[model samples]
Target: MNQSFELTPNRLRELRGFAIAARLLNFSRAAHEAGCTPSVLSRRIAALEEAVGGKLFLRTTRRVTLTPRGEQLLAHCERLDAVMLAMAAELRPQGGEPAGRLCVHLPGAYGRLCVAPVLARFLAGHPQIRIEAVYDDAYVDLVAGRIDLALRVGRLADSQLVARQVGSMRRYLCAAPSYLAAAPALHDPAELKAHRCVAFSGLRTGTLWQFSQGRRRRSVRIDPVLSCNDSMATREALLAGVGIGIQGDYMADPLVAAGQLARVLPEWELSTSPIQLVWLPGADRAPALRALIDFLSSEL
Candidate 1:
């Protein structure tokens, strides 16, 4: 005799709730994806936890993080992407050429020295593409600022946005020959405290210069005689023999070779920071932005 049983889909709902929560790793964000309130999402997740007999997330005031069980389950679930591009002749118009205004952001010095030249070629190649480039040292919110793309330096934290590393950034501790001659002998990073330092007020790491020698690392707090937020002004001060300053490779390399500035602390070096081409979460679906990103990654 066959046993009478009612088939239920509570498990399916539980799986879906768990999947969205695990992907976003935040109740609010996952709730947005599920088209539900965060409180409702929380209850769904709780029901899922009870059905699975384990807690799936570690909740906190700041953020929600996945537990081991959540990680394992997420590893098996298919990826959910914000950007999906379908390339087909059926989807193309008479002229499928991508054309539009593309707004981009970059650091002032990096944009002028490195990116502008490449962007020049990209614009020349695409006649219909117009660009509005904003150069600022401050980090701008892609969504709030309505920026389509940006070139970023250094390490990036985990985010829903996509990043593609294109190149590297190198910084050096440098001074003019006159300043080095007038200043005291500076062989170690500890000596920076004794010498005059030109600080860039824009450094995310503050006034301290961090260095690494072999496996050992050290950070020295700087006391600057002159501080400037502008890279050009800082470079001028370093060239004027006012004080030692950390300079980007683009500006320092050419000048150093010409004997305008000397690189200090040759033994201790700053790690190479990454140059990333970053964009919004769903921006890959945009043809113009995608082309520009590809062009930059290839040229740079």
Candidate 2:
């Protein structure tokens, strides 16, 4: 005889955990998002598997993959999630203030230097809402990570997501006054080959720096004396006069105004990257999400 599966609150929690784990395909990441331990998540999945009468995932040392059963359950869970969100929207009082958990993903240095400063004011305005901010330079899937919103810088490639251009990011090739004072006279982009440089490992251009003077374009290949993956680290190296490097205007402008750094080849310009706020469609229906979006759109 087969046992019937009942959806108790505990069972619902277990199913939610299963859904998150299935979406991420990694127990560790799923656990982190679920606000629980991996062992606890594993146990929840085990209980869920027993209730469903089969294994949900095939786990190995390298990766996790969903079983056929898990795929079917995930489809149902997604449908349920949509229904719950819609129901909540309907039940909310008209003109009700937004109140809920809002998960946001942001670029590491930019979030700290720009967005982080404005969050306190946002929170003060929406006293009922709680924010979970994840700062990282890596791109994460909004659906898989269960993120409500993300701030991205550069040309957006994800056509599936709705994006709003909040501002523009301008990069400047700059160095400390000390470095420029001692280094050889730097006039043209091509002359960069002779100078010691600092490279950002995360830049798509790699070691090839591109600049434009009107319609004239120039690309220079530089072997850097130092390289860093983090933007803050690169900025520190530049401040210490390690070598000349490209710095974003948001970070470089204040330093430049304060006379800490000097621009190199001011006549040439780097491509401007767009700063955008992105989210999955229909996600803004939630008042809290909409409120945060509006606040950031105006602030940033």
Candidate 3:
């Protein structure tokens, strides 16, 4: 009869391989992280499953997701890894400042002017940290796309995602000097019906221009002569004297300054949109994520 439990090399290797694979959720990514190939990683997972007599993954060509049992095992693995890392850091002679890869998503306009400056200084201060910035207007799925942080505009939907208000932006009604010269004098939002209005299709307002006067707010529907999905295109149309336009302040500021576009109804403020920095709730603990938030909050 055996008195002591024998250590098995196959079981130990499988345990390590499974933990890494589970953490990444992609065989190719896990293999790359482990300095191996996907084929080898797949074989390791298969061997691990055979040893445990249970399947750990459900494979598909397009996506790799965690199974019920895999999620449970992943939690345990994460805890164990955290404990080990903590122990290692405590035992090490000197572990200086926080450092890691921070993935951030930003709008194209804000990223160029606002985010870039802050990131430059942040990188200089924290030499060890790497920033991955994704700038786009399209919707991104954070968890599935592996995004660490995102910058958003306008009202936010009620959700589990954590948000921090960075600043506010306003929309302005503008037209070229030449175009406004020939058009009828605009006194109110209702007058937009007579003037040719250039529309950006992305704006949620349904062919309706909303404005505010003192404490009163009103929405007036209009028939725009031209429409485009992008602000850049709309700006071009306005430059060509196609029609008047409603656009964001940041995009309008330069044109307004250059006298290419004139802001109409400046005294009356319309809708004000808020800028926000959004991230997954639990990602606060991640060093890179925290660093980015701190940098942006201070700079923006």
Best by the lDDT measure: 2
Better of 2 and 3 by lDDT: 2
Candidate 2 regions with alpha-carbon error over 4 angstroms: 1-90, 93-95
Q: What is the lDDT of residue 52 in candidate 1?
A: 57
Q: Where does candidate 2 have its weakest 10-residue lDDT segment?
A: 1-10
Of 1 and 2, the candidate ahead on TM-score is: 1
lDDT of 1 at 226: 94
Would you list the C-alpha lDDT of every candidate in the order shown?
0.80, 0.89, 0.76
Model 1 per-residue lDDT tens digits across residues 195-292: 99998887768698899999989899998999888787899999999999998898899999999999999889976889998885446566778889
Residues 167-236, candidate 2: write the lDDT tens digits: 9999989999999999999889999999999998878788899999999999999999998888999999
TM-score, predicted candidate 1 vs. hidden true structure: 0.72
Model 3: CA > 4 A from native: 1-95
Q: Candidate 1: deviation at residue 137, Å?
A: 0.4
Candidate 3 — what's its lDDT? 0.76
Q: Please say which candidate is ahead in lDDT: 1 or 2.
A: 2
Q: Give each model's clash number.
A: 0, 0, 0
Candidate 1 — worst ten consecutive residues by lDDT sum?
A: 1-10
